[model samples]
Target: MQRMLDGLIKFRQEDFEEHKALFSKLKRRQEPHTLFIACSDSRVMPEMITKSLPGELFVVRNIANIVPPYKEVHQDYVATTSAIEYAVKSLKVENIVVCGHSNCGGCASIYLPDEVLNNLPDTKKWLELAQNVKKRVMVHLEDETDEYQREWLTEQINILEQIKHLLTYPYIKEKYLNKELNIYGFYYMIETGEVFIFNYDTGVFELSN
Candidate 1:
């Protein structure tokens, strides 16, 4: 806590002061260009990675960067959907990027035994959103014995799955079909610091130049 407080003090004295004009303008209103959906991992810093300013990107982070499918009657409160609705309908963001990272605990938890997730009932239920990821991976990549390869593939597949779910929203679909909004899937390699972007034409994720 002290470390965070000290960082806050430094931010106020140095970072904030240096970007005072930008922050001042942002203080009144924000018009971010992109909606960045990323993982709740502390190591994944969306702003730092994209070098975006305070008001440039509206972000929503959740476990495994999952985006649940659009449904008229949601059984429970969903912060992700609310943020997506606001970003697309109200904010009118031009782009949406669903980013999944390497070595995601949420992705790994999908393969764990029911007993393992028994204590974390909510998390278990939440991760059910990515169950399709597991099903596809098991059927397609059954020969992949390498732990790292399996996890990496699952992370990338999860991003694609989330993107599909994102399109389930009518507003997003309308904008997307009209070519007014762009949707992208990103996979970040934490160890290598490389980003792979999904290519619709090739149906594969290639290294971002």
Candidate 2:
């Protein structure tokens, strides 16, 4: 806690002071260009990775970066869904990136038994959003036995699934069809600091040049 406080003080004294004009303008309003959905993992810093400024990306960090399918019936996902709606409809963000990372606990949790997540009811329920990814892996990658390989595949699949889920929103779909919105699936490899982008034309995640 002291470390964070000290950093805050340093930021106020140094970085904030240096960028006072930018911060001052941002104080009144913000117009971010992209909606970045990424994992809540401390290891994955979307801004740091992308070298994005504060007002450049509107970020939404959650467990596994999951984006549930759009539904007419509202449930407990108001926070996530509302952020997406506001980012798209209000902020007019042109790009939406669903970024999933390697070594994601949320993705790994899908392979664990129900008992393991029994005490974490909310987490268990929230992770149900990634069930389709797990099922896809099971049916497609059934012959693969390596644990790390499986997890990596799950993470990539989850990103694609979340992108699909994002399109379920009417406004997003309309904007996307009209070429007003671009959706992207990203996978970050923690060990190597490499980012891969899902290429729609090739149907593969290729390393970003």
Candidate 3:
């Protein structure tokens, strides 16, 4: 808490004064160009990774960066879906980027012991939304080695799966079909500070060289 407060003090004294005009303009209203959905991982800073300034990207972060499919169950209007609807339909964001990162505890939790899994009830339920990814990746790669490479590959596949979940919303589907909004899937290699974007045409996540 002291560290965060000290950083705010620095921002107020140095950064804020330098970018006074930028902050002033933002006070009127924000017109961010993209809705950035990413994991709540400390290493994955969306603004730092994208080189975006303030007011450029509206962001929402959640465990595993999962997007639950639209459903009408009781008390179903959750934070993730509500944010998605507002960003796409109301805010009229031009693009939506769902980004996942390496060394994600949420993804790894799936392989954890029962005692550990039982401790994270909320995370467990949220992760089930991406259960299809686990099934597909496991079955298709049954003989494949369970090395670090496989985990990274599965993580990228999960990003695409969540992207599919995003499109399940009616408003998003309509805008996507009309080509009004572009959706992207991204993976961040935290260890190497590299980012890979999923190329829909090639059906692969290629390094953003």
Off by over 4 Å in 2: 142-144
Error of 2 at 104 (Å): 0.5
Candidate order (lDDT): 1, 2, 3
Q: Per-candidate TM vs. native?
A: 0.97, 0.97, 0.94
Q: What residue runs in model 3 are displaced by over 4 Å at the alpha carbon?
A: 72-74, 142-145
> Can you write out model 1's per-residue Cα lDDT over 1-209, one digit (the tens) per residue?
99999999999999999999999998879999999999999989999888898999999999999999999878789799999999998998999999999889999999989999998999999999989999988877867677777887899899999999988998899999999999999898888999999999999999999
Ranking by TM-score: 1, 2, 3
**Deviation (Å) of 158 in candidate 2:** 0.5
Alpha carbon deviation, residue 71, candidate 3 (Å): 1.8
Cα deviation at 67, candidate 3, in Å, is 0.5
What is the clash tally of candidate 2? 0
Residue 90 accuracy (lDDT) in model 2: 95
How badly does each model clash, as a count of residue pairs?
0, 0, 0
**For each candidate, what is the lDDT?**
0.93, 0.92, 0.86
lDDT of 3 by residue, 1-209 (tens): 99999999999999899989999999978888999999998888999999998999989999889888877553854888888878887789999999999988777766667687678788777777767887767876655666576577678878998999888888888989999989999999998989999999999998998
